[model samples]
Target: MLDKLAKAGDIIAADAVTRAIAKLSETPVPAGVHVEATEGGVLLSGRHLRRRMLGDPQLRNFGK
Candidate 1:
C-alpha cells in the first residue's frame, strides 16, 4: 500500500513538472535568457536576470 501510494505521488509530480515545462516553453523570454527542461524542473539562465526579475513586483507575482 505504501509503495503504491509512493508511485502515485511520483507520477503526479512528474506530470506536474512536465506540464510546467510545456507552459514555460510557451512563454516568451528575453534575448539573452535561455530555457531548458530538466528531469526535476525547468532551468532559466541569463546574466544577472534572476536578481532583476525578482526585484520587480509584477514579475515576482507571476506564479501567483
Candidate 2:
C-alpha cells in the first residue's frame, strides 16, 4: 500500500503523505505504528518538525 505509493515516483503523492505524517505527530505520538518510506527521490521532507530545539536540517533522519 504505502510502499507502492512511495515507489510510484510521484512527488505530489509522496509529499501528501509526508505532510500528513507531520500533522499526525504533533504530540505524544501513538505507538505500535511503523512508517516506512524510501529515500525521498524527488520530494525532500515536509516533516518540518523540530526535536529538542533543533530543527529539520539537522544531521538526522527524522522519520527513522
Candidate 3:
C-alpha cells in the first residue's frame, strides 16, 4: 500500500512538472526573443530580457 502511494505521488509530481513546463513554453516571448523546446530542454534567446524573466520573480532584475 505504501509503495503504491509513493508511486502515485511521484506520478503526480512528474505530471505537474510537465504541465508547468508546457505552460511556460506556450508563453509568448517578447519581440526579438525566441523560445523553443527540445528533448534537451527549453532554449531561450533574444535581446528582450523582460520576456525571459517570466515566472521567476527572483530574476526580475533581467526584466529591468
Candidate 4:
C-alpha cells in the first residue's frame, strides 16, 4: 500500500544519508589531522608546522 511504500522510502533515504556520511568521514586529510563525530557533524582537528619548505603539495607527496 501507499503507507508501506512511504516507510520503505524513508528507510532508503536514511540509509543513503548514513552511507554518504561514512564516505565523507573516510576522506583523506593532512597528516596528524584527526576526525571525530559530533552531535552536529564531523569535527576535524590537528596541528602541523607551517614551514616554508613544508607545503600542502609537498605533504601530499610524502608517504607516496
Candidate 5:
C-alpha cells in the first residue's frame, strides 16, 4: 500500500504509515484493518485504528 501511494506522489501518507508501523513494537494491530493517508492524518480503515492513533476520542478535544 505504501509502495502504491508513494508511486502516486503521496509521500506524506506513505511516510506517516511507515512511521506508524515502526512504532508498533508494543501495539497489536487488529484484523481487517486498512490504513491510508489523509490530509488530517493517517486514516485507519477500521475501528481499532481509532485507539491505535488516538488513545480515546472522548478524552481528546478536536476543536483545539
Candidate 6:
C-alpha cells in the first residue's frame, strides 16, 4: 500500500512539473506584437499592442 501511494504521488508530481514546463514555454505576448532587444532590456510594441495584449475579440478580423 505504501509503495502504491508513493508511485501515485510521484506520478502527480511529474504531471505538475510537465504542466509547469508547458506553461513556461508559451510566449507571453500574442502574435503580431513586435519584440525589440534594447540596451536596457526588451521593448514590446506594435500597431495593435493594446488590443492584442487585452485579448480583443475583434482582432480576429484584423488586417482582413
TM-score of structure candidate 4: 0.55
Off by over 4 Å in 4: 38-40, 47-64
Structural similarity to truth (TM-score) of each candidate: 0.57, 0.29, 0.62, 0.55, 0.27, 0.42
Model 2 TM = 0.29
Per-model lDDT:
0.71, 0.45, 0.63, 0.62, 0.51, 0.58
lDDT of 2 by residue, 1-64 (tens): 6987777768887788777666444423223323343454222333432342263233144344
Q: In candidate 5, which residue pairs clash?
A: none
| All models, RMSD in angstroms | 2.8, 11.9, 5.6, 6.3, 10.6, 9.3
Model 3 CA lDDT for position 18? 75
lDDT of 5 by residue, 1-64 (tens): 5888667777776776667654442243445555454444544566665565466443233222
Whole-model lDDT, candidate 6?
0.58
Residue pairs with backbone overlap in model 3: none
The residue-by-residue lDDT of candidate 3 on 1-64, one tens digit each, is: 6999999999998887677666666666556667676544566776655555765453343322
In angstroms, how far off is 56's CA in candidate 5? 18
Q: Per-residue error at 8 for model 5, in Å?
A: 8.6
Evaluated at residue 15, the lDDT of candidate 5 is 79
Q: Tell me model 4's lDDT, rounded to 2 decimals.
A: 0.62
Model 2 global lDDT (CA atoms, 0 to 1): 0.45
Stretches > 4 Å off in candidate 3: 38-41, 47-64
* Predicted structure 3, TM vs. truth: 0.62
